[model samples]
Structure formats: C-alpha cells, structure tokens
Target: MIDAEGLSIKIGAEAKEFDGEARFSRSQLTLWDRVTQMAIAAGEEAVQSAGLELGDEESLRAGAVVGTSMGGMHTLDENYDLIYRQGKSRIHPFTVPKLMPNAPASHLSMAFGARGPSWAVTTACASSNHAMGQAFQMVRSGALDVAITGGCESQLTFGVLKAWEGLRGMARDACRPFSKNRTGMVQGEGAAIIIFEKLERAIARGAPIWAEVVGFGASSDANDIVQPNQDGASRAMRAALQDAGLGAGEIGYINAHGTATAANDRTECAAIRHVFGEHADGLMVSSTKSMHGHCIGAAGALEMVATLGALRDGVIPPTINYDEPDPDCDLDVVPNEAREVEIEAALSNSFAFGGLNAVVAMRKWRGA
Candidate 1:
C-alpha cells in the first residue's frame, strides 16, 4: 500500500486503502486495472443506492459514460518499468486491454449489464463534467432511461508524478486554493459514480432523488493550451445559465474549478465575475479541491459530491488550507470552515488544460 503522507512527492491524496485483491476475485483483479477497479466499485455503490437491479429489460436500456484523463497509469508504468528497468522479455497479456481509456466504461457496461450506449470521455480536468453532460443529454432527448455516469482516475505512479513535477505546478506542502501564498495543485485519486434515470421511473420505484441536473455547457479557449482563458470560462458559465433558463441571481453557490495555481485561481474568479456580475458578490463560491486535492479528470465528479451536499444539507464545504487571501481571487471562497446556508440552485465548474471548460447547473429537487 502506498503511504499518502510518506510519499516522496510530499503531498498527494492517494487512496491508499484501495486493494483490488481484497475487493474482487483473483480472476477479476487480473483483467481490470486500478482505474477500472475504482470505477466498478463506485458504479456498484451507485446502482445499489438507486435500487437498480439491472434486470434483462432494464439492462437493455441502461448505459454508462465514464471519464478519465490518464487511463491506466499504474498498469502502463509498472509494465514499462519491468521492460525497460528490469530488461523483461514479456509483460502482462492483458496490458493493452487494461490501459485503454475506454476500459472503465466498457467494464462498467459489462458489470451492470448495460447495453444501450457506453463510452469514455477524456478532456483532462473537465472529463467528468463532459461525460455527465453527454449522459444527461441522452436521457433528456429520450435516448435512454437510465445512465450511469461519472469519472475515475488512479494516476499516482512514478512516471505520472515525475511528469507533473516537470510542469512545476505542484505544491510542496499542501493544496491551498485562492490563497495568496498558494504554491500549486496537489494530486488525488478516486472515483465518483452517479445513476441518472427518468423522473417518472424513479418516482414509480420510489428511488431517492438527490438533485436535478438542470443544464450543461462546454467551451474551448482556442487561444492557449496550458493557460486558462477567462473569456472561455465566462462563456461556458453563461451558456450553462442560459441552458438552465435561470438568471444569475438564482445560483446561490458555485463549486469552483480553483486548481490553486495562480493563473487558474485568478482567471476563474474573473470569469465568475464576468458571468454573474453583481450576483457574484452573493455567490458562496468554494473549491473543495482544497480538501480533496486535485483529482484531475475525476475532479468534477468529486466536487459534485460536495455540490450535492450543499444542495441537500444546506452546508457548503470549506476551502481548507486557506491562509492569506489573494486580491486577484477576491470572492466569497468560504475559507477554512464549513457554512450552513440554504440554497436552491448551484453550479459546478470544471476548467481544464488545453483550454477546455465545462459547467454543470443543478437545482434542489422538491417534488413532482
């Protein structure tokens, strides 16, 4: 098991407790990568929570859409080390199948017996939101009744860490978003899966309804690859508000894509201000990444877990590790401590590298 605190990298939110051997049978562990294992575990929990049996008829209409930035870094890294470092003649036979980007989604389909439509979305940090958006559109357009969607990532390998170090965007000690003294992002690993089904079907089955996925918006910067574009971020948020048929005033909280990098933090605040205008002052914007660390492709989904908590429990998760506030990110970041405030609507932001951005708008579910 990898020690989260004892890592040579200094800071990482690694899922150290994750063990495929303990969670699955021997045959199951051989074929699936750690990424797929996490995805399957999350998917199974979602299916059980949603009271979905995936019967023959239901399975025919159910589908899965998962997201990830790096698919199977552990598998690839281990095999590469064996070949190049140890001068091995051969690697695992299931290496290719386990490392493919679509492996999570494909494995999820087989696990749940879903057959309608299944695929994986890879958009760096915005991957999960994009995947969930695609699933939402499919269900809204009457293409499918049940959609299992989210993201998974387990990229804490030697090669991945070294590559991140080369980028020099990692904090030495901790993740402190929106803080003036913030260094950069801290890496994390995990998965979060959600089951989305028709409201009527949910009602008929008495399934617990959490929140309604109201709108989705996506945009590309088209200007820079590494740097974040404020204009592109603003456009995506504006598009989400328009799609939700909601005014800026209706959104009470915003789950920011604050990655702790100076450019990302400042750019995101500027975009929020541009989109929300005066309402920006009233928005309880916070970056859960401060606590969970940056999950890369799974960032949006993990933050969605925080966003849903705000909608359901009227408590906003704090942006912990905040020391000194930066003037550039002068927004209500709910620093250091959680706050209780009832909110009816909220938005989750996911702005990624390569100038990709995706936003999801959700509203509290009252009743039919």
Candidate 2:
C-alpha cells in the first residue's frame, strides 16, 4: 500500500470567525484575485504544517491539482462591462490567463515549484473531490512523493449571480438546509488547499498529520445536467465505503450536500437512505452550507476542511438556520451549533450540477 497520510486545509475569506458568525469579509477586488491570494496564503500554511520547505527536492516531487467550476466569472464580467459600456477596443492582455479555470492551479504550481504534476480538474461542484481523489491515487501508486491539492472559485460576480438566480436555487435570505422553509443555496466565494504526503515521508519529516485519505469514490449520473440522481449518489457512497474496507455501520458522521433546495435535500436524503439503510437513523448528518453559504466550485474542498476539523477537534459543526424540519428530509441533521462527537471515520459528500457525485472518506491519521 502507498499509505498516503496527513493533510491540511486552509479556509478563505468567506468563512466567519468563530465569534463573528454574522459577518463575513467583502472585497472591492474581483473574485479571481481573492482566489489567487487565498491559494498562496493557504499553500504556504499547508507546507509549513507539513514541516517541509518549499522548493526542496522532496517537496518538488509533490504535486498540485486544483479545480474551479466557472473559471473567472468576475474578471470576465468586468472586461465585458469595460468593452460594452465604455466601448473599449480591446480586452486586457491578462484577461484570458487570469480568467482561465486552471489559473489557480498554474499559480499554485509556480508558487511552490511542484514539478511532478500540476493540473486542474473541472466538473461543476464535483471538481475539488475529483482533484483530491486523483491526488490520492498519485501517492498511493508511488507516482508522487506528496500532493498539494484542493479547489477554489470566486463566482459572486453579477453575471454568475444572475445565472444562478435563473437556476432558481438562490435563497432570498440565508440557507436553511433540511428545514421546511428552506429555499436554496446562496452563492459564496473562497478557496481551500490541502497538503498530502506518503505516510512514511510525513513521519520521516515529523509532520503533523490531521487525517488520512482512506477512501474516495466518484461517479457521474449523466442522467440530468441540473437535477441530482439519488441512485448515483448512493452507489458512489457504497463504493467509498467498500474502498475504505469498512461497512455502513462503521461511520458515525456524514457531511451532507444539503444545498437547502427542495429537490436537493429530498434527493440527497433518499440517497442516504439507500446507502445507510437502518444505520442512517444513527448517523449525525448535517450540512454546513447554512453557515458558510455554497461556494460553488470551492464548496467541496472547503467542506473537506470542515470534515478535517471535525476529526481533529472531535466536534461536528451544525447546519445553521434549521428550524421546522421537513418530513422529506427526515434525517438527524445536527442543527444550529457545533457538537462534540467521536468520529473514527467520516464521509464528505458533494453532488454538483450535471449529476456529478463525489464522496470521500477520511480518518484521523495514526502515524506508523
């Protein structure tokens, strides 16, 4: 076995400080700039967390994979405004590069000097999971010594927000997942990065391992572009469990997709029922989107950060704004505040537009 171990995630500007849950940071700059800055800051933090120096031969052997759903919507919007309203003759030279979906990965690779492999994976909201899953394989197969992987997006621009509004998935107020009064997701912006290394490499370097990528499974519904497929999600979950060498009964917690949409909550609940069956009743399932809003392409990796925090701190953050429960989403959604729990292994589920379902299993790292 390749025994890849220890990962670190750095949250971006959208997250609220523990005490300041009501307010979030806002910037005059475009979302793409926010993503670039956050990636640099987080990448440095992850490397330091691993107790390794960037540009070191071993670290260079490490890899990078990033994902984004809408590429650079904000930048695109700004340029369009300049050209259309102001009658500008040409777009900025940096426009295409900065607005590219793969820009974040390119920036990361250049910053850290990771020479092994640097690429971006894009699949709507499932992007990050796919990136992380590929990184897991790279280390497991001895193709890389370590992997710095995650996803980022800044889709809160006018054009993107208008597009999401057309989808009718935007909540007028705040997200209320699994709640009877729930409406839909709120578009948010952010990025999250994680550092992954072989178990032996991390131990040799005395790295602090937060968790291990025990299992990962991904599948596409290809059934509908906008709607979710419960059957596809259930199959992916089962595959993740099997890959982890565990059974449904072994899991104590699940970080649900719970997008607060009528279709999403019900369909995801059905998927949970299909996979966990009787054990679903005992699982502490919740969606954190109620607190952070949905970060589109950035959602999966950011939620992965939350999952790792749950493992390290032994507490699961609640799905805020949950009041009256919907019979359709009748699962035990840990609502309103963080709670303590002993989570040996946990699942983070992300289902995106285009019926993409990605599930990953994580466990507290035990150094050998």
Candidate 3:
C-alpha cells in the first residue's frame, strides 16, 4: 500500500528513482517535469534500440506522438501546496511548460529532432493506444517514415491520489483482474516508447523488428462517462480485425484492458466474448495490469510490450493475483503463472473514461 499525505491505496506501483543529474544537465532537469524526463529517457532507449539516427534528411520524415492522462501532476501538486499552504506568492518559472499536456511530446520531438507531426494525445486511460494508433496510421499512410511513439505518466501525487480515492475505484490490497474476488484497480506510474518505421525502411536499415503492427482501430461509446460499453469495445475489436484482414479466430491472445474494477473486468470480458464468439473459448486473454498495476495512460503501451513478448518468446504473461475463477470472465486468463504457447497474432485493448476505446493488432515479424 502507498500513502500519500495520509490518503492511501492498497497498491501503487512506482518506478524506481533514477539520478536525474546523471541523465540530464541541471538546466534541462529544471525545465522538464518528471513526465517529460521519463518520456525523453524512453524515447532515447527506443531510438537506440532501433539504431535510428535523427537530425538528418530522415529526421524530416520522423515524428513523435506521446500520451498522458495527467501530464504533470507532481509539479501541480507541489506548486499548489506551496501557494495555498505555505502562502507562497509565486510558483516555479518553468511550471507552465512542465505542466502542459504536450510537454512530453514536444520534448521528445526536440530530443530526437523529429520535425513532422509531433503531438500528444490525452484520452484518459486510453491515451497511449490512441496515440500509438495515430502514429501507426501516419506511418501506414506514408505521412511519415518513422514515428517515436508511446506514452508517459508521472501522476502519483497527493492531489491525484486523493482524486482517485474519491472515485472509489482503487483496490484495497491488490489488483486481481478478471477474478471473482477482485476489488478494484491499483495505480501505477511509468513510461514506454517504441519506434515505428516503414517496412522497407526498417528492412533496409536491418533494424531489429520486435513485432509487426498490422492494424489499429478506435471508437467512442458515446454512452457513458465512467461506465464501459460492451458494444463499443466489441466494435473496436472487430474494426481492428477487419483492418488487419484477419478473422477473429486468427487472434491467439489478447492483452485486455482489465482494470481489476468490478464493472470494467466484467464488461471487458463480455465485450471480448461478443467480438470473438465461439473462438473466445480458445483465446488466451490476460491483463498485465494485475502485475504492473493500472498505469492509466501508459497502460496500453506496457500491455503492448507484454503482447509483443508473447509473440517473440512464445510465453504468455500471467494475470497475477488472481484468486478465484470468474464465470463472467471465463476466457483462459493464464492466471497466476505464465504459460508457454506460441502466438502468431495478438490484440492489445485500451478502454478509457468518456467511453473511448482503442485496439491494436500485431503479428510475429517474419523477416521481409
């Protein structure tokens, strides 16, 4: 459990503290919030992993798209505390730039010299998937040859924790997605960035391809602000399948947007069943949120990492902390323990507040 100024939750997964001075100059650190710093670090790692060199002719065709729910909660909380509690007259000079929703994207673009289509997507929990889907579309449509895309979040602040507590959607002990005994979600903070490149360009550069992004689909429920809609989720999944030119049966695994909340877990299961029909019986579905905690905006990107791992290593990550069977969520959840199974294709699902939903379809990369 994590306590924030006496407001505590059952579980909160926070990233290990890293030395900012080691990673950035003092001036750079002062200008960027933790969210933007984390984004820059993730972007750097992804760029290096892909062996991508920006700031050249290729950079003109590169872009950066990032996502976040609350961009700079820590900075806002601290500043508010200083002003309201301590009677401070002014806040940090860089507060505005650090707290802006697009700071992470803007900083990433500047860091990598990506001059094209740089922006951020803010769709609550579904931000990452929406952002990644947008980047995928741009690359697929020839609008850009490369995209530095993913999500970053550093929202574990006193005010943010209290706000989430007011919603009564946070778990008391653990995150147990799809389990009958599940309580609610546990908050997490982190970042994940991936490089998306045109197929020919990636092959030409001999970059290591983790997985192939085949399709993306997004839809809005237009039904509820907090409650999820099964029809909307099913439609998004079907659209992704259609765009991928694949049948529902072709999807071997699903990285579910299972928040461990009672409504979300049950609703997501119903949506999966509705979309997959009889094939749902054999599909291996799991929510990595059980292990990583619900990362909010970064949830989809982290789950996508798990999905890619399944495709690459033939091992499906488990939905940890699952205690009992859930008849409503009867699909194979691979609960408690990891399972070794070869999966050719998978889908990562993200459903957010305000009924936004996004799904991404991917397959094991067979060298082109």
Q: What would the per-residue lDDT of candidate 3 be over residues 188-285, giving only the tens digit for each residue?
A: 98889999999999999899999999999899999999999999999999999988888898999999999999999899999998999899998999
Looking at model 1, report the run of 10 residues with the lowest lDDT sum.
1-10
- Compose the digit string of candidate 2's lDDT tens values, residues 76-135: 888998999899999867778777888788778876788888888888888888888888
* lDDT scores in order: 0.91, 0.79, 0.90
TM-score of each: 0.97, 0.90, 0.97
After superposing candidate 1 on the true structure, give the runs of residues whose Cα lies further than 4 Å from its correct spot. Answer: 1-8
lDDT of 1 at 282: 92
Instruction: Tell me model 1's lDDT, rounded to 2 decimals.
Output: 0.91
| lDDT (Cα, tens digit) per residue for candidate 1, span 238-345 | 988898888999999999999999999999999999999898999899999998889998889888878988998899999999999799999999999999999999
Off by over 4 Å in 2: 1-32, 54-56
Clashing pairs in 3: none
